[model samples]
Target: MSFLLTSCSTYPVEVTSADQLAGVWEDFAGRTVEFKGDGTFTATGMDEADVGEECSGVAATQQGALSLSGTYADVTFDGVDCEGMMLAFYGSPSSFVVCFTRDVTAGGCTGELSRKDDVTATGRHE
Candidate 1:
């Protein structure tokens, strides 16, 4: 008799709108975060050791039949005192959040994306 093992594959499920991510968000350290609708976001700053190295790239957000993507610059957090950059993504009519981090070395960004009243996705950006 022979036995075989099967692997499972999982794809990322995309959230359609920024309205799905409305709420007061908190980082792993319990810091309050605010994501604006007009493609603006604010977070308590973190440290260089906390955020890691800088990251340069682009990100996109899609709503219904509309999609927007753009290049982003590096920005350190405001209050947390971390050495990282602020990354913004546009979604929905006026929904967007700014992500701040040096790199994906640590657990990742403290904030997350949410839908309705539940966490749709959580993790650091690579």
Candidate 2:
């Protein structure tokens, strides 16, 4: 007799640079960010536990390469001023993660984004 088995593997890649990363990327936590490919991005629904409550829905347009090792941008709403950084967390490659400099939370990093893309029947994106 013989038996057959199946398996799948997940090898997520890290976003090393902020180049060519365009399109509307949505996280499992309902946060969304639209990268315009010009070092300026527009986002909405960013006031989550992972994301910063200080700023949301309004992002500042800056001129320069927004990289993990370079200049960060402002994502303040209603003319508010707060520095926000976008990068793949050193621990892992996180999607749509926005690290703020003024977040009251520890480390000031947003942990809402997820890699799970399937929407289950329970209405949960997990």
Candidate 3:
């Protein structure tokens, strides 16, 4: 005689929201990033972070639009500044991926932007 057994595992995945990305996010290199509901974004930095920072184009997203598009000019990063465009899809409010052209100085930086996670918003860093 023989017996069979079955097992399964489950994990929880966090969902993203447009509101989560509405605030400003800064990188380790002191860069301020803000995403607006109108499919617009603004980034400010100094030196390396501001090598080619410029907002050239604009876009819009409706209530049901799942993707966002925009253009940029003289954006800089990683010691390289170039002009290019960026297309980002809605992931979670905390995380997102920006696909851009070669106009910016830096390549692509992927990370999370969370105001709640960073206590600095409340003047506390711990």
Candidate 4:
């Protein structure tokens, strides 16, 4: 008797987008993420080791929207119903330049919009 084994993959294999902002953006730690035209993205191999920080290494599917206005492409993810906004600066020779902002509040887990927010950090595309 003969037996065979196979594996399944959910990652996108062929990603073609005319939009300049569509492509793989690898952060400082090496998480090669791809933002599809359909407003969905998947990033595997994302862990604290790759992030070089304290974080739960759990894979998840996130939906978002991408908007291009003048010189910036505003991308927002709805994993947490407003995780934050990843602002991508256009017209750059570099691979990518993005900054993220989170909705923080004094009352933890209240899910209320805070009056003030801060930029978490900026990352580049790989």
Model 4 per-residue lDDT tens digits across residues 1-126: 111111111111221232544556544444455656665555544433332222222233334465654333445444433333433332233222332222212111111111111112542112
After superposition of all CA atoms, the RMSD between model 2 and the true structure is 10.5
Better of 2 and 3 by TM-score: 2
Error of 3 at 4 (Å): 46
lDDT on C-alpha atoms for all candidate structures: 0.32, 0.39, 0.33, 0.34
Locate the minimum summed-lDDT window of 10 residues in model 3. 1-10
> For candidate 2, lDDT tens digit of each residue in 51-91?
34443433342222344433234333344443563343212
- Could you estimate the TM-score for every candidate? 0.35, 0.43, 0.34, 0.41
When superposed on Cα atoms, how far off is each prediction in RMSD? Answer: 12.4, 10.5, 14.5, 16.6
Clashes of each: 13, 1, 12, 0
Candidate 2 TM-score to native: 0.43
Pairwise lDDT winner, candidates 2 and 3 = 2
Question: Residues 1-126, candidate 3, lDDT per residue (tens digit)?
Answer: 111111110111132444434666554344455655543456554232122235322211111112222222222222222334333222322343332233223433333222434535443322
Whose lDDT is higher: candidate 2's or candidate 4's? Answer: 2
Which one wins by TM-score: 2 or 4? 2
Error of 2 at 104 (Å): 14
On the 0 to 100 scale, the lDDT of residue 11 in model 2 is 24
